[model samples]
Target: MLTFEHDYTRLPEPLWLACEPSGVRAPKLIAFNEALARKLGASVVPDDETLAQWFSGNEIPSGAKPVALGYAGHQFGNFVPQLGDGRALLLGDVVDAEGKRFDVQLKGSGRTPFSRGGDGRSPLGPVLREYLVSEFMAAVGVPTTRALAAVASGERVARQMPEPGAVFTRVASSHVRVGTFQFAARHGEETTRALADYVIARHYPEAREQDDPYLALLECVTRRQAELVARWMSLGFIHGVMNTDNTSISGETIDYGPCAFMEQFDPRKVFSSIDEGGRYAFNNQPAVAQWNLARFAETLLPLMNVQGEEGVELAVEVIRGFEAHFDKTRQALRIAKLGLAEDAGDTADTLMDALETLMHQGRMDMTATFDALTHYAEGFDDIRREALLALTDQPEAFDAWLEQWRAAPLLNDATRFDAMRLANPVVIPRNHRVKEVIDSAMEDDFAPFHTLLSVVSAPFDESVEARRLAAPATDSQAVLRTFCGT
Candidate 1:
């Protein structure tokens, strides 16, 4: 049996609305994360039907108190003053063996008061996508929400076409988002302070020791987000929708809607069908994160000890520090990817810039290029060297850069190869592969989905099977745009 705590419910009433999950017709368990369940201290192994019943919201787990969280967001630069958990319910909190609290949520469980005229259901494709991609992100060492289970509703949801429905059970540190504070700020100063206090007590207890806890909390969140965005960039991951509500206070990547990994090296790449202006493009993530943090900062101004323009100046100072935090993390990542020592310094920066320029000009496959470099670093063989060169249209320029990289202050050959291997994944959940899995699952074929999941779970394995999934999509197989599945 799973036990849960109700700390969030203890918060002010405005933050969440008590509700029950709208049960589905027929629930069939499609996936269960046994390893994560064990980590969360769930010892009882229930049968598939029972697991489906609980996860699909047909039978709410004992000790669970479901609620729809309230928050407003700036969606694509437009402020939506009232948007909340339209199709999801927080199924209380769980404390792991290590005593860390995590929010257990059932997404696509059905509608709540915040449904706003839309059906509170999710199509199976998105449930599968989030399960695969979010788990892949966790495996790759990215801080992200985890999928504990997925259950098919055995029914259909209305989209452009009638699509099979599913519910996803997600675990995260907490669901508090920047937009939560925005909603709180609208209620009054005391409500915003209460929300901030709850967040600090739950996520940043260390801030309590600081001279100004609110200011310290803002800095902590800003720094975490900066580093998180930097990590995303290093992996060529684009989080297609970067709304304020999707930005977590705990700094984990949340809401895996319309998200994709970059196949080709393009700074301006945008895969979200709704992102016509390329607002949340691949390279624009860092800036968008800073902008979101600025919004978060606005909500905390009234609570800051310093009043008037002084508090604004202080907040602005912390917000501007995002650039430094991001650059430090990004530089360290680049150095590791290049297999260079920390002391290599400016040489690594110059070399990285030149290589990225070549990649952009050639439209090189980002993951493949890094994998090729990892192989070449193992030993300077003709075949491996040629493989790296093949990814570039300007082979001669790449060849020159390769010599510079080889001669730079790198670690010993063994250590350098090991570093590159760890930094560059052998496989990612490629856009085409994910799309294929979704299409196959829609036809009741799950073999491809399982195969892709297993391959991505061990992203650094250089096995023949992993290499088989490493290739980028061909022109015919490329997925140009992705939908939110709303």
Candidate 2:
């Protein structure tokens, strides 16, 4: 019965027309982020029925505005004239216990005026996929959007196959994206500055202290994005898509479709079925991030204080630092994965190159290869050594690399090695495993879904009961292609 206050109607001009939801009949609650719910000062409502009652367009939460946000995006290489929240509605921004502002968004809530003649509903698979991978990313130390909850829409929506529907409770620092600017600037330069001002007041207040807040905003986003792409590489994450709309200004991971973790250590891995040209491949993510940041820079050009060419040069310089920053952070992360904190200079790359070569030649287990290294050095037990031996046909080659690794002055004592394993996860949600879970869920079996969640929740520890999670699937279960649920 708590009605949320909304002041959007008093905006400088109409942002979006008030619209009702379509394509939703019986919305059901699937899951809730208790951590984020407490952060947002929201309490649980009980069962899926209760959640569905609220989301079925039959009930509206008071004090929350069901407003659609406006933003444009580049689909591939082409720009769309306009794109906004088609199936999503903002339930308003909530301040956390620490006073940080975060937006509460509902995906598949229903349709808005932006629906554009399509069914504005999220199928169950993508909802579950986002919940799985987003939570996994957070556990693995990556900055990303968090899934608060998922609810089934007691209704079914038609996609490749007719499927039960669901809604996801997504939490983010702010919904502002690079595409957000593209929308505003296209409206007018005044609208552009206004949006930038709102962003500064809301997220980056320190930018207001600068001489040129708008340009400072651009620089801040670029720096954060550069470092974020670096972190992704360090963890072997492949975003699969780098569209401008998919880029969040808050630097938290957003839009969880078609994303996956690398399995074979291939920098050129392209898991998203839509990425035919490998534009956003595993190795290309860093460059793609720089490219997106460059677009952000171009959007902020009107506020740039420097002359034309010089401003462009400064933007180029900032973008140039992306690769260097990515390399530096990834190298440091690579060292920690190998159980060493200090860099071994060129030796680190040398050993990494050797590992990649061995893994590629032997078709090694990507996640386990780095993790097993620590166990081999620490336990020295046959089980640990055997784990390493199983990775490839080239134990002699790996042994040679391990000698160089073990001889490199140990950065930490044996106890520190134990701590490093905890830092670097041994298990990740592999594509094949994700596919298996999805396949089961498609058949209305939640057992596999829950099983995957349990194993993925603690990716570092290897329980004998959960040993299956550590092992790659047999050759037949190998998943070579992943698709966008669209």
Candidate 3:
């Protein structure tokens, strides 16, 4: 039996709306994450029939207190004051055998007050996309929400065309976001402080020990986001939508819609079809994160200090410090990727920038380039070198960069190869491969999806068949723009 604790629903009435998931005619289990289920302390597995009912929201589990969380967000830089969990309901918190707590939520469960004239359903494509990508993110050691289960809803939702519906069981540390704080602040300072105190108690108990608890909370979140975004950069993942609502205070990657892993190493690449202006491009993630944190800080001003002006000054100081923290995290990631034992200072920056410039100029595949370099570093392999050099427009330019990289003092360590192996993943959830999975699943063939999942589950390992999935997209397979299927 699953046990739940409704701490979020215990908050003031305005913070959320108690609701139930809309029932579906038929529920079929599409995928179940047995490992993740075990992690959440499930001792017994339900029969397939019952499992489908529970996950699809056709029947609620015992002790579940469902509530739709309320919040507002800045979508594409436009403030939408009342946007919230329109199609998701936080089922409640479950404590695992390890004594850790997690929130169980059902996305595409149905509409709530926040539905905003929308159907409040998720298409099969996005559901499979989130399930695949979230699991891939977890396997890669990135902080992110995990997919517990996926169930076909036996219903149809009209989008660009009529599509089958699906519900995803999502697990996270907490659903609270930067946008949540903004929503609380809208109610009043009292509401904002209440939310702050609750968040501290639930997520950061150490904040209570600080003289300025609110400021302490801000600093902690800033550090997590800095590290989080740097990790995304290292993996070549673009969040696509960096709106305030999508920014998780828990620092986990949330809202998988339109998110894509980069194939080529262009820092300016954007996949979200809605991101026409490239506000949330690959290189712009750090700045967008800083901007979102600034908004979070704005909501905490009242609780920040006794005087309003003092609070503003304090927040300004804290925001300024975010840059140094992010720079340090990003530099360390770059150093590891380069297999450097010590900081390379200016030489490191020059080489890394030059490699990226070459990638942009040559349209080199991001994952392949890094993996090839790692192989070349471990042992001077002519095959690997030639294959990588072939991707560049000017092989001479790459040869010159290689000379500089070899001359760097930081590469003297005997363990550099192993370090690079750990830093560079041989497989990523390539856009074309993911499209292959989605396309096959739509036709009721889940073999490709399962195979892709297995390959990405061990990203750093070598598998000959998996290498096929790592290839860059062909002309017909290239998915230039990703959509937010709302």
Worst 10 residues of 3 by lDDT: 340-349
Which digits, one per residue and each the tens of the lDDT, describe model 3 over residues 1-486? 568888887677578998888988788998898888888888888888889999999999988988999898888888888889999999999988978789999999888888898877888888888888888889878899999989988888899898888999999999999999899889998888888898898888899999999999998889889889989988899999999999998889999899999987889999999999999999999999999999999898778754578788888788877888887877887887887757575566677888999888888888888998998887667887887798777799888888788877667547888888788888888888888888887887888988988888788888897788878888899989888789
Candidate 1 vs candidate 2: the TM-score winner is: 1
Question: What lDDT would candidate 2 get against the real structure?
Answer: 0.74
Q: Order candidates by TM-score, high to low.
A: 1, 3, 2
Best by TM-score: 1
Model 1 error, position 199 (Å): 1.1
Model 1, CA-based lDDT: 0.92
lDDT of each: 0.92, 0.74, 0.86
Per residue, candidate 2 scores C-alpha lDDT tens digits across 248-307 of: 988888887888877777767888888899898887887788888888788788877785
Best by lDDT: 1
TM-score, model 3 to reference: 0.97
Candidate 1 lDDT, 1-486, residue by residue in tens: 678998898888778999899999999888999999989889997999999999999998999999999999999989898899999999999899999999999999999988998889999999999999999999988999999999999999999999999999999999999999998899999999999999999999999899889999999999999999999999999999999999999999999999999988998999999999999999899999999999999999999899899999999999999999998888888999999988876887888888888899988899999889988988889999999999988899889989999999988876988899888999999999999999998998888988888899899987888888888999999999999899
Please list all clashing residue pairs in model 1, or write none if there are none: none
